[model samples]
Target: MPHLSLSDLTFTWPDGDPAFEGLDAVFGPGRTGLVGRNGAGKSTLLRLIAGDLTPDRGSVTVHGRLAYLRQDLTLDPNRTVDGVLGIDNQRKALHRIESGEGTEQDFADATGHWDVEERAVATLDRLGLAHVAPTPDALGRTVGTLSGGETMLLGLTAALLGDPEVLLLDEPTNNLDLSAKARLYAAVDQFPGIVVVVSHDRALLDRMDTIAELRRGELRMFGGNFAHYRETVEAEQEAGRAAVRDARADVRRQGRELVEAQTKIDRRLRYGKRMVAENRYPKIVGNERKSQAQASAGKLRGNHADKLDEARRTLTEAEELVRDDREIRIDLPDSVVHPGQQVVEVADLTLACGPTVSLAVTGPERIALVGRNGIGKTTLLRALTDMPPRVPWRALPQRLDVFDETRTLAQNLADAAPHATAEQIRGRLARFLFRGNDSDVLTSALSGGERLRAALAMILLAEPAPRLLMLDEPTNNLDLPSLQHLTEALAQFRGALIVASHDLPFLREIGATRWLELTDDGVREVDPR
Candidate 1:
């Protein structure tokens, strides 16, 4: 069986930041989903397993052949299907052996190459790549004519042709069409070897036999799929939060007892002094009693201090187990529409891709534009912006390249608006939840979620205060927190919104009033529920 083991594995980047520290783990014969937030070293771990990056210390032991499929692949338009599957030389040697012109070396090479053609054909047929490989002569056809998704699947086929013991896939489903994604998922399901895939796609993760989470330089194994792992983590977080609350209460109680003890000691000391003055007892006896009281007070205070310290330590440990899941709160007062206000109007305008959507917005309306890749969603959004709508509009693309990273949030907003006063810009940023010192934060210093909010702020906080906003795949590269932040902001937007996205959960959360499904014949209304 194919397997992998890492013994005290450690890795650090060239920039001096540690990616993994003393990581020790073993992967056996099963499909494992490697999950974590962006920059949590999930991809880095995959690279380490694939031998792309050498470990800083320790060793990786492999029991069988390994194949790795990376995200950014280089394509050669002139390559044939046999070449793409990396079986050209072997297939050629087999051909030479069958033609009676085979040399001794060719005959030797053809020994293992006998079944290479059959195996390549079967793999291509399974992945829906046979259609692009030229039906009669699939292996002889050039792959330059293949689609993007076809190209990716062809690469996966090449990986599987070797029948390796371990296969590592990094974001294999990214940018794939629905049909391609389904085909890839099917391939993963039927694979018999150990498969480790790094992906943020929930649907893909849910197909795994086991989940391994890489968080904060620690590796954790969970049985079952992504849903099961999430349930376990949520339960752990609940218990951790309860522990934190209990520890805090204990600290408070200890503090109160310490103060009360001091007060009682002071009262007793004063009483002893009064008794000595009144000659109720000998002055020496009173003095001795006072000294004893002071000693007891000091010991009591020390004991309470120790208890407080222990409680604090307990609180810190509990906090480490609990993850922060705060969502953003948006309040854009400027986007409000009074009576008789005009919004964007889409007349029976048919798009170049043949999608005709006609709607008039007079209030805060939210529209969800969804379809498969290359369905003219972005083109439609760009068309809407050119309609010369009654209100100002801005569209946020997937890259979010609007903000100047070198400038602060406030400065960026000011640069966009230009006419807005400093106070105005800051107040607008506050609506996007960037209040107080957050205004001075550089765009480069913000998290993924904060950067998104900053982008939205700059758009909606324009000179005329845009009432029409368009967004394209806002949740593409966002982690969980960033996704939540985007949902929160969009849900509360007081303006019109037309968002094109494939995230069903996000669309449901925003409560989109109109769901437009772009189809072959323009767009059809669908219930996103």
Candidate 2:
């Protein structure tokens, strides 16, 4: 079997923050999906496994050739398809030999290089890039015009061309459209060697043979796909929560017993003192009785204290097993709009991707704007929000431009909603779960979930509080928990919403009243369910 294993693997960042510590894991010959929270170090673990970063202490043992497809490798605008596929050098050498004017070394260099173009073309074709021909000109096609999904697929093709037996992919589906994701999943399903992918895409994870979760510096493996992994975790969490409740009750019981014991001891001591004062027995005999009572009291108190301490320790352990995923409780009281009120109306508006759209919104209508990647979905949203509207509106672009990284989250929200007093902003931040010192954390240091909450605050709490809110692919950058937070927040919005997203599950969760698909011709109503 083509085996990959890690023994006592450990890693830390330059700033002394540990990403992984004493991590040991093994992979059999199949696709394994890795999942975790935003800062749980899934990418770091992949890097460590791929040998891109050396472990602080331990070993990575691989039984076959390895290749890694990085999640965020930015392609140069000038780079060609052949370059992205990593066969530019080979193609160039082969071209030189094929040309009428060529040196003898060029022919020798082209020995193994001749088949590079063929393999590249076939791989790309297999990945649904049949548009990329096998010709030299097609190989020279630039990557600047390719969509984000196509670029990602191109990277995967390059990795495949290496004929690696062990492949590692980190967030391979980020920013990819539904079609691209489907193609990627198919490719993963067809891989002949062991593959490990770290991604938040549920559909992609479902195709995996196993799921591995890294959390709180520990890596755990589950024997099945993402759905199975989630089921197991959910059951375990339920049990853990019950354990915590039991432990807490035990602690309280022990506390009550300790207090009762103290009270009894105090009563006994008072009785002993009274007997001594009364001279119920001889002075020496009374003194001995008092000493014995004091000793017994001390022993009883120590016993109860020990029991309470043990109970507290058990409670702590139980609490650690249950994740504390705080939620965003959005309350937009000022944004409420009556059912008869008109929100926005547009007619025959041309989009950047050649589609003309026209739509009207009223009351608390929720609209889901969905389309393929590189289409005019985002552009249409920008155009709609930029036009003069009869009502107050706000837009949250996919890049989250609403935040200023230099300031704290509270400061950023304050800047966004300058008309509001500091107290108002603090209250809004609290509802988003950034309470007290949490709101004071720098925006740059905020996690993906925190940033989402801050972004919500920046737009929704702004001046002339928006009655119509527009968000562009909000779920693209969010983790699973953050996605849920966003859904929860959007659910509470009592205003018109125009959300552009490729996430179907999220759109459904938000209870979008209307589904609008931006086609090449124009926008049309479609039932995504």
Candidate 3:
């Protein structure tokens, strides 16, 4: 069985921010879901394990061969499918031998991989990429023409070809469509090696054998899949809350006891003074009795004070056990439309991808755009938002590149809604979980989830308050918490929404009123219910 281990691992970014410190964890022979907040170093940890980045200290050990699929793939546009798969050289060598131009060097280069093409085709087919593997010429097609989902599948196929014992995938489902996602899920299920995936896709995480959470520079492993992990965490949190309640009650009781003890001491002291004033006893005897009384009172006070301090400490410990997962609380009152107001109208619009879409949105309808990869979903979204409609609208594209990277998040929001005051923008940002100095952080430095949140803030805070909001794959790179926050925020939106995403669970959670599937012919309405 393949295994991966990190012993006392520590890492820090170029900016001197520590991502992980003294982290120790082990993964062996099962699918493990690596989860964390956007900046919690899930991706960084994957990079370190894949040898893309070196840890500042400690060691990373892999007991078998490893392959890693990165989140962001920067492939040359001119590279062919075969070239991207890293089998181009082998294929050329086989072709040379077949054409009677064989040389010793040719066989050496081929390395008995005469069936490499067949294996490549089979791998591509397994990944639902048979469309691009029909012929040799098809495999020669430039990568520039491939859809985002297809490119991702191609990357996966390339990784699969290696048949590594340890496989690492980071956000593998980011650009995939519904069908592609299913295929990827199947691949993951069938993989026999040790699979570690870092993703926000709940459906994918639900299939894992274990869930490893990286939080505050520590790795904690849960015994089962994401669903199991959620159940465990919820139970622990409930217990933690109960403990806090009891601790608080103890503190209050201790405080009251301390006050009562002080009151008793004061009464005793006053009585003793009166007795002395009356000369109730001989001088020496009275003095000795007074000293004893004072000592007893002091002891009682010290005991009460000690109990109170201990109670406070218990409360602090109890509070520390509870998780502080803050959610984004936002209400877009200005964005609400009238019950029957027309939000969007598309009349026989032809997209650049050859799809003709026509539709009308009224009131606060939530529409989900669904389809396979390269079926013009993103293209349709672009077409719908390209020209201004009757109502105010905003579109969040798949690429979250709407901000000026060098500027701070506050600056971007302010630029989007220039009429709004700095104080107002900051207030709105706080709702998005960007509090105080967080709002002043540069957009370039934000994590994937943080960038998405910042983009949403800018869009929702526009001057006119867009009544129609369009989002293209909004949940791609978000963490579980960020995804939950996004869902919560969208639930509060009273305007029309057209979100193109393959995350069916998220769509359902957001109360999508209608579902539309984009196709080569046009857009077809599907029953969401």
Candidate 4:
């Protein structure tokens, strides 16, 4: 078993905003899920632990070797599969030694790794990349030829080949198909080392032994999986709300008591003034009594004010314990379709390298498009958008590159809906959690989740609206909160929907009415349950 400890870690971006400051955590053996909202520094923390990025202050200590699989993996097109696997040199050395053309250095390079090729093949096979493993020149194949999902799996395979005691995976499931996700899940479950993963995939988090959440520059660890963390946080929030309620009541009660006490003191002062004015007692006696009354009134007022201040402090402390769980709220009644209206009519359409099929969607049918990677799910979605039916339609591509990166979110929405005014665009974007100046942010600067939200705003807020909406892997890079907002927003949409995704739980959350699986033969309807 190995341990990874972060002591007083601090890091800041070049722009001067601190991603993390004085953060500390200890991760021992077993799988740990690192979850947080977008831009919460989950990826930054992982990079720090991997030593890919240096911290501005403090240190990251690892008891054993460490390996990291980054979220965005860029490989040279000319690089071979073996090169990407990092075993090419060892394999070459072994081959040279075997062919009697090797030097002493070749033996040293290949020492203890004589079966490196075999191990590499086995690792790739375990990760569902066996198709590339068996080819005679598979190891020499160009990386550009592999699919995006296959490339991600290859990265994981390389990491596993290193056999590091501390493994860090950043959004490993992104772009992966369902089968690949399953394979990755199995690998994580069986891994004996300390595995720390930063992902938004709920399915993957459910398999973790611990859940570590980073929020607002602090790290909090919760025992068990995501489910357990959810349960614990929900319970804590409920109790916090109750405490706030009690504290608020106490403040109100103290306010009323202070007012009553002040009223009594005012009455006493008025009586003392009347006694002095009427000469009800001797001048000296009346003056002495007035001074005593004033002193008493001042003491009473000070006591009440102090009590009120103390009550307010207690209320503030109570409020601090409650979490801010705000969710997006949006309504699209204009995009709604009648029960008898035809949404989509695909007649004898042939997708690129996909099945030829005919389908019709009436009313607000929600379709879940599922399939393996490279089976042309994206192609099918594009084809549907190309030959749109009588109704207005829009397609959200997997890449989410529908917007102009140079422009702001508001400008993009305005461009999409030429008839809409700037105020209208901003108002609509606000519902998508882009309030005020947030809509002014450049699309290029937006995070993955922010970009998705901005894209959704542009599509949904366009002129005439889209009654037939298609989303291709919309959940790919979304954080948990963003995913929830997406699900909620989709649930409120009354238009026809075709959502292509590998996240089964998300599909179910949005209430998919129809399940369609794309295959080599064609698109066929199936039961998602």
* Model 3 misplaced stretches (Cα beyond 4 Å): 74-77, 100-105, 339-342
Top candidate by TM-score: 3
RMSD in Å for model 1:
5.6
Global Cα RMSD, each model: 5.6, 3.7, 2.2, 2.9
Q: What would the per-residue lDDT of candidate 3 be over residues 1-529, giving only the tens digit for each residue? A: 7889999999998878788899899998989999987777888899999999999999999998898998876577799999999888888788889999988988998886777888889889888988888766577777775667888899999999887899999999988987788999999999998999999888999999999998888899998999999999999999999999999999999999999999999998998888888999788887888899999999999999999999999999999889986766656646777888988888899877677889888898999999888778877777777776668888898878899999999999988999999999999998988997888889988877777888888998997888888999898787677778788878878888999988888999999999998888888888765
C-alpha TM-score for every candidate: 0.75, 0.85, 0.93, 0.90
C-alpha lDDT of all candidate models, in order: 0.77, 0.82, 0.87, 0.85
* Global lDDT of model 2: 0.82
Off by over 4 Å in 1: 72-125, 128-131, 134-154, 177-179, 325-367, 372-472, 494-500, 513-529
lDDT-based ranking, best first? 3, 4, 2, 1
Point out where model 2 deviates above 4 Å.
Answer: 1-3, 51-63, 76-78, 104-109, 132-136, 325-333, 337-347, 350-352, 385-392, 399-464
TM-score of 1: 0.75
TM-score for predicted model 4 compared with the true structure: 0.90
lDDT of prediction 1: 0.77
Task: Please give me the total number of clashing residue pairs in predicted model 2.
Answer: 0
lDDT of 4 at 354: 47
Query: In model 4, how large is the Cα lDDT of residue 32?
Result: 99
Top-lDDT structure, candidate number: 3
The ten-residue window of minimal lDDT in model 4 covers 325-334
